[model samples]
Target: MARPLSPKLSPSIIAQAALDAVDHDGEFTIQGIAKKLKVSPSSLYNHIDSKADVIELMRGQVMGRMDLSGVDSESADWAGSLRIIALHYRNAYALNPRLLPLVTAYSVRDATTIGMYNLMAQTLRTAGFDSTRQLEIITVIDNFVLGSALDAGAPDNVWAPGEAASPELRAALDAGLGAPDRAQKSFEFGLGLLLEGLAREAEVLG
Candidate 1:
């Protein structure tokens, strides 16, 4: 019998199956993905070596959603470039908040994800950040973006101080919590603060 024109499974298919599982169940297993794909668990090994490989593929799927090429390292507007990249990164993860923990647990070996980092590094290098500072800046941005992404999935009432709440804390939550696009507004506000500080640091480094 002749084999089918298209192979039975591809990396993208496997990754998407696992991602679907994660999206619904908050985790995935090789067997689970195989069942989802209507294939035996052993067949999954033909396309993926281990769970880490599937995680990387899922990472790539998320990262592929962002268009990083729009970042203009040559423009010398490092803050602008960084902001664009950060927003893109945060938005991508916001779609799959459950995947965030898994991706963070594993070492990032996904080419697309690494490419996004490379663009950010290039933007920093172009703006006069030294190699040491580049990594630090990238890490800071990564932490902030991930935290903000998690916030996107936060409950409408992120904090419920109730009777225990101080007047100031209660007032703050009353004004901000449950606000429309609260998470996005907060992320932008925080991003602005970070960019301002980094801009000052860049000036001092010059």
Candidate 2:
């Protein structure tokens, strides 16, 4: 007779196994994870409350891989640090596209998530932004980074892959009226515009 599976696996080990399963299969399911770990489905419940909890754990694992320590809160170039953070986030998403959705929706109520955001907020505050303004800046930067990553990760020419553009769209393209160069040009443009607005606001407040 086949032996029953062990329930002795650590939560971290189970969580890592879950991520590996998702990475290898390009999909995830509780039963698949349990099978991968050689544990009973019920045994997984001893470690994680639910599938969402497992996903959240995986999300934190992904974030943990990022080098947040490199972001210097005392740097005079705080805006530059913010840019680096944005790029770091983009690179992280690029490396783990399978985890993008989970990371994007991960809640900040978790201490790790809140700590990450607070680090950014502290950097902004050190850069001379008041508490209220620091939060606003953080929110803007978060939206910008997440939106830029989503745009960059989208399939090129998604509406008609490998097909000629419609005459109207092609004509627009010829007139330099097509979608903006999304990868770098658009990111820099948005960043510059946001910084300009913030600078103007600072001047007005002073």
User: What tens-digit string does per-residue lDDT give for candidate 2 at 1-206?
Assistant: 98774657776677688778766776578888888778788888887887778877776666666687788887877777777777776666555566666655655544555667877887777677898888889889878876776667656553442357787876655654335554656777888788777766756654
TM-score per candidate, chains pooled = 0.94, 0.72
lDDT of each: 0.91, 0.71
Candidate 2 TM-score over all chains jointly: 0.72
- Tens digit per residue, CA lDDT, model 1, 73-181: 8677889999999999999999889998899999999999999888888899988999999999999999999999999988998998779999999989988889979
Ten-residue segment with the worst summed lDDT in candidate 2?
154-163
Model 1: per-residue Cα lDDT at residue 46: 87
Residue 200, candidate 2: C-alpha displacement in angstroms: 3.4
RMSD (Cα, Å) of model 2: 4.5
